[model samples]
Target chain A: MATPVMDKAQATATADYITATFRIRRFNPEESDAVIWEDFQITIDPKERVLDALHKIKWDTDGTLTFRRSCAHGICGSDAMRINGRNRLACKTLIKDINPDKPITVEPIKGLTVLKDLVVDMEPFFQAFRDVMPFLVTEGNEPTRERLQSAEDRERFDDTTKCILCAACTSSCPVFWNDGQYFGPAAIVNAHRFIFDSRDEAGEQRLEILNDKDGVWRCRTTFNCTDACPRGIEVTKAIQEVKRALITRRF
Target chain B: MSTDTSGAIDGVTLYDVDNPAPVIEPPRKRTKKTPKGGGTNFEMIAWLFMRLSGIVLVVLVIGHLLIQLVLDGGVSKIGFAFVAGRWASPWWQTWDLVMLWLAMLHGANGLRTVINDYAERDNTRFWLKMLLYTATVFTILLGTLVIFTFDPNIS
Candidate 1:
């Protein structure tokens, strides 16, 4: 059996801080046309989140470091960046979860124009969302009380309702990265949310929109969107469901 | 202190209200050619066809591989005589013909999707698909003809 001294020392070592290097892709149009990689070495606890490290860099090291983040606990869907070549929310990823022994690489999400260091032009992503008519549609007179639905009907689209409009899934899609015209996985996932709702009467219209050449058909079912979604939504399955709905509508 | 009213900091021109950058349209935005809320369901049908034909091709292709490569004498048994014997039967002729058609169409549709995904330019996509369709048609027709017009006795 080991002595108590070793146990106390082990506990102290467990709480000890280690130095981590963050390699971030920085692009400032005012500074230069080329994107530059800057490394920041910080002494941090392993249990600290990546977002905390970023804040430390911005606050302590460089005041010009820019990144979009809100509701730092993964609710706002912001702060989604390419962490180690994979799309992940900085707030949700811990420093030690990823191999911090090597320099951690961070960049803006792909398939969108990088406006600054980590911010991307999101107008295109939102435009696709609007084109799908994501809101519920009803033609009849408003019910005096409320629109009632069965438990099963509500459960049908429950999986897709969790979308926070984060561009993580859309940016990770290879098809979208190659061709921006393709309505990405996030747009299809949003359409799935409305198309399957039993109360929504605009399923046919949404189906028609998705049946276009650049809509749900563009999805090759690569499952990258599913893997990139920070909210844990099965985005590829939702796209497949929309494709199925389109087919069954015809038959 | 001199104020920089020219919207240029040092030497680079600042893109501000005074010197605005050219507007860039959002990708895939609707236009005159893009009709709203109405389009054909050809892609949906094509997608469904791929799935259905894929299931059928698994049986057809595996059965074909087994017969041609793994049965009785394996590859050694396969020659002009074996092909002639198989083609002599109407059932075998029909089987080969269906397999040819399904495999070609399935492969063509899959390539069409690949071309659509990778080829960014319009003319490139059109020409590539045209080439694909031309090849697909020629192969399908030649295969059908060979299966139908095959003669058992050839000099």
Candidate 2:
């Protein structure tokens, strides 16, 4: 790993800069029917994220090179892409984290149509997210005050609330690659967030929606989502919990 | 995706062409707790059964191999008399019977997952699974018969 950039002096140390090659897959819908991998060499701080290298390419070498990014930090979830054949956020993966010597291969996340270089058609991803009703539902009138919640109640579904809807976990899945109809992992993670919420009254409806063949049943217990999640959500365990809830009829 | 207007031999024509409007069907919703016709989706049960059977098989298969291939004087001590002797006891008969059934079902279920994952064509998948079920049933039935109907007095 690159020496952790602790203080200012180490952060910009000239000696820490190294030359790395970025081999990026380029696709132009307007131009060619085929895609091509273009390579560019650049010198960068080893501690910098892969997004920094893409910025350099876009600014200096090829202005036509395209990608998506807003918050350079990891929280935005806008920069999720395939780096070195794995789904990861471009902003979180450092140059040193993924073999700085070997040409860093950057491509869009799989199982989605590439609208541009790194921009995938996120309609399906968002569609699945919307179908899960990633919101709290209650049958009764609104609570008079800020709805009272104990710490224990808050902790039940806490782990699943970290989902950023990045689609990294979903697109990395082999099952999703095979069948797009399957509600991918991010949708399930979002569902698990609300389903286990002690205050949510509509948990049963969400569970019923997931009980369909293309729903939670298609998961197949693959741990790829757990591995691919940049937010460190226990995706597979959450899926199993949903399955158990379905089998036992207990939300 | 017959979204393009072209003959089999002709190249696809871009949007300057006429094609049928795409069909958009919402995802098929399921209301039944079980699959339609009030039967369980046996595949889900089979998946759960795989793990349970796997644990049992590890014990049954290893213990069987130890007694037959290692514990006695090896394979040399096993012959027709050894076979007849083991089947004479009801316990050994039941052990072999359980082993036979579990191994057959477990292997068949595992192959079913493989077929679901790899078989691309609908007809090919159906026929291949039929063949697998046929062989599995044949072997299981024959093995069950041999275990229960052994003469033991045969030369």
Candidate that would win on lDDT: 1
lDDT of 2 by residue, A85-182 (tens): 99999999999999989999999998777777788877777877877789889887887888777999999889999988888999898877765666
Q: Identify the runs in model 2 with alpha carbons over 4 angstroms from their true place.
A: A1-15, A220-222, A248-251, B1-44
Fill in the DockQ of model 2: 0.11
DockQ computed for model 1 against the true two-chain complex using alpha carbons: 0.21
lDDT per residue as tens, model 1, B1-155 = 16434435677666644544433233333333444444676887888899999999999999999999998999999989999999999898988999999999999999999998788678999999999999999999999988988987888
User: Which CAPRI category fits model 1?
Assistant: incorrect
Most accurate candidate by DockQ = 1
Q: Compose the digit string of candidate 1's lDDT tens values, residues A1-251.
A: 97556777778875778899999998766554456689999999889999999999999999899999999999898899999999999999999999899999999998787878998888778878888999989997998998999999999999999998878999999998877777798889999999999999999988888888888987888899999999999998999888878777678
lDDT of 2 by residue, B29-67 (tens): 112221322233454566568879999999999999999
The lDDT, on a scale of 0 to 1, for candidate 2 is 0.81
> How many steric overlaps are in each model, in order?
0, 0
The lowest-lDDT stretch of 10 consecutive residues in candidate 1 chain A is A27-36
**Candidate 1 stretches greater than 4 Å from native:** A1-15, B1-38
